[model samples]
Target chain A: MYDALKNITFIIFDLDGVFYRENQSLEGTKEIIDYLNEENIEYCFFTNNSNYKIHRYKEKLLTCGIEVSEKNIFTTTKLIEHYLFENNLDNIYVLGSKQLQDTLYDKYTQNSINPNIVILGMENNITLKDISNTINLIDKDTQIIAANPDKLIPVKDGFELECGVLIDIIEEYTKKMVQVIGKPSPYGFDTILSKFDKQKSETLMIGDTFETDILGAKNANIYAGWINSGNKLPYNTLDFDFMSFKSLIELKEKIKEAKR
Target chain B: MYDALKNITFIIFDLDGVFYRENQSLEGTKEIIDYLNEENIEYCFFTNNSNYKIHRYKEKLLTCGIEVSEKNIFTTTKLIEHYLFENNLDNIYVLGSKQLQDTLYDKYTQNSINPNIVILGMENNITLKDISNTINLIDKDTQIIAANPDKLIPVKDGFELECGVLIDIIEEYTKKMVQVIGKPSPYGFDTILSKFDKQKSETLMIGDTFETDILGAKNANIYAGWINSGNKLPYNTLDFDFMSFKSLIELKEKIKEAKR
Candidate 1:
């Protein structure tokens, strides 16, 4: 595990589970950040969540006692913005959080009649009628894009429906493919790599979820680590090899030992 | 086509497209009902909708200038009541409209902690949090039941999500099968047959939708007729033979012609 850490010059961390879970910072969150800075390792935070603005994530990291430049944070919203800019796409209709809608609408025209793109994200109060209206807005030429393909995200009580459920409903109804912009898609990973000028072999992704984080790294052809924060692996993951840590403290210790 | 209608002693009519669209009665709605009464054929209105009570449907039919007893109405809500009575199941958790919840809870205990059965129905204002709360209440032993398996129902503007989407999300998440009690499953048809003491060969199902109305009749081993109320057959349905009419007037003419 220590040997695997030696060549990792660039580290991408999943914010929700790895560093903090729902406003509480996990153990060694600050220590790991300090260690990375002292060792001159390039690091950034990446999350599949598009419900909040980039500034909210920056504020969340500040609460964890770790502060970083806004440019080092990657949310699905940011990646989608990058995609739209790259493709020169406009005339958007977003079915998502107010934060996401406000952010995107500030940059692009909000077209409900016939949009060039339909962006789906997670929201708490989405109704069946709202979904119907969104579906009605799509024409044959309309493009569909989703924040992430995560069906559910763990909450304090139980799992909450995610953006993937919306994607499932829309895609199944329309018989059209939705381009996903978050983890496990390689779009966000490639964007990070290109922005930071990092090589795949030298980059490591640390996350708690295997589906989005670890499998995402594999899909992007990068080093992966699983932070076992009491979340059980959904299946037997013996087929593939990846570094596993019981907590962020163990990961920090491993990095220290690797330097020695 | 007239020959097939000669021996039909019982008729099951789908309400939404056959009788009315929204609140407006379709062409020949009153004529068909009057003709059925004149022929002394037993008939009833059956709808897959569980969002409304039987009295609401009774009133809606009355608006179409057809008066019928409440006993002749079969909504999914009534069928679900029959299902619970037949199985002697109680302690329910309902994820549906206020009308559905109130109706079921009036007869059965509403157990949110650990329900004996989770009943799913369609509602306009259901939120993601509501769905998550419902999913959390289900244990390994909890039985899941849905009012219908219709994915989308055509509305005035476009299609609205139905009970089938809820079943899709819940079944996919829990890896459990949901017992569907509405059209295309034969449960509702079986209940209607048992109530009317009618045989399959002597029964006829007339509706506008192909998937639920036509396919359901075929599943129940009854004669099927498509009303063709401006709703196109979704696929090439040439393999199986069923009677088709452009309007309810045509169906009334066919019945009169057959008797003559």
Candidate 2:
């Protein structure tokens, strides 16, 4: 374990595909948790899903047999909230669920007349009227914000459209691009780095997706470990220097061998 | 009028921007109707909007001060119905209004499992659940048909998301391209040409947009007269030969000159 992780002082992990999939923890996750605890290495889980708060995620991780502090988890929801607060973007039209809307309730507005921004997030109840109203509000001055850049999220039977898909729809209709504040945007990474005081060279990003995890790590100037679990490869990762493995155990072994 | 339309025995006029805007008739539309009638010219109104049937469009046109037969109108809805009927594609899942759904009610399926085709059309009350269900039904074998390749429809104040926009969202989520059956596709043009036995050289396609009108005309190998009424150019027309005019009056004069 030391041989594999010797060069990395800090690690950024993706929650959905890396640690667990569909609420079930992966096999090598326990070993990695033990190893990380033994090595006293700094790590954090960076998830693009804005569906839940960080505390909820902390509780969820606890149930999955992974003990992590609330501060160790950085969510896109939190990142977006921070951005909105910092930028003084008080008036917002959220096209997401009540839970997601509550994340920025202080700044959210029903004032369509002069909205500061329009935030796109996951909403099972989102309607054409919601989309049309959002379309009408979009102009040169209106800032369109997308929570994440993921096109789809795998479901029980198939895939479900995510925030990025919604953003693309709005962009196509209005011809105005959306500002994604999640993975691959460098904003989330920058926030994590700044908050944790971590150096780019000393940190590594681990996840299963190439577009969000690997591409995001590249954008943030960090090493990436792609957990390719025979899932579909959506994006081209040929240009990046990323290590790919079927399991976290294999990746750990490779890292161990390299350090040795 | 005879000199301009001497060679053109038939004309296909687009309804939305060419003849009317927001339920109001445009200038020179009445004169064109009279001129076409005086010359005993064969003409039809080709519209991409599928909200109303041919008879309803005729009534709407009459109310707008243009008298035309129901047979002299073509819509994307009609084009889709014809395509579905011809191809024997009976099983369908529609993400559109009850009226549009009723157009093919005999074949419409509410079965979430193994649908033959998913037809995307205009729906004001479309929900995310509808989008999700459609996403789940999408596979390699499933045929995704879009009514038109339009991103937005011009509403009273602003624009609303169109069928093509819904198609785009589904395409992005499913990673499967949608087969557009309207406008720039040439399928509609080919059908009209074959059924009506019209010569491409003798027929003119006149509209106010480049994407559908000019592009579709180019694809169908017909002359296009763009009624560019100060709307921002959304597509490139550099590769195609199309007449551009601020008003249909100007286009009429140009067509008259060419015929002379």
RMSD (Å) of each candidate, 1 decimal: 2.4, 3.6
lDDT tens digits, residue span B100-163, model 1: 8999999999999999999999997988888888888888999999999988877778888888
Give the poorly placed runs of model 1, Cα more than 4 Å off.
Answer: A1-4, A236-238, A252-260, B236-238, B257-260
- Candidate 1 local lDDT, residue A8: 83
DockQ of 2: 0.60
Question: Candidate 1's error at B136, in angstroms?
Answer: 0.8
lDDT of 2 by residue, B1-260 (tens): 23434588788888887777776778888777876777677788888877787898887787667888777799888888888888888677777777677787655545457778888888878887778878888788998888888877777777787777687678867788888888988988888887778988887888887889888999898877778775667655577777677786776666667655
Reported per model, the fraction of native interface contacts reproduced equals: 0.88, 0.75
TM-score (0 to 1) of chain B, per candidate?
A: 0.96, 0.90
lDDT of 2 at B236: 59
TM-score of each: 0.93, 0.86
Where does candidate 2 stray beyond 4 Å?
A1-4, A28-31, A107-111, A170-177, A228-236, A242-260, B1-4, B28-31, B107-112, B170-177, B228-236, B239-260
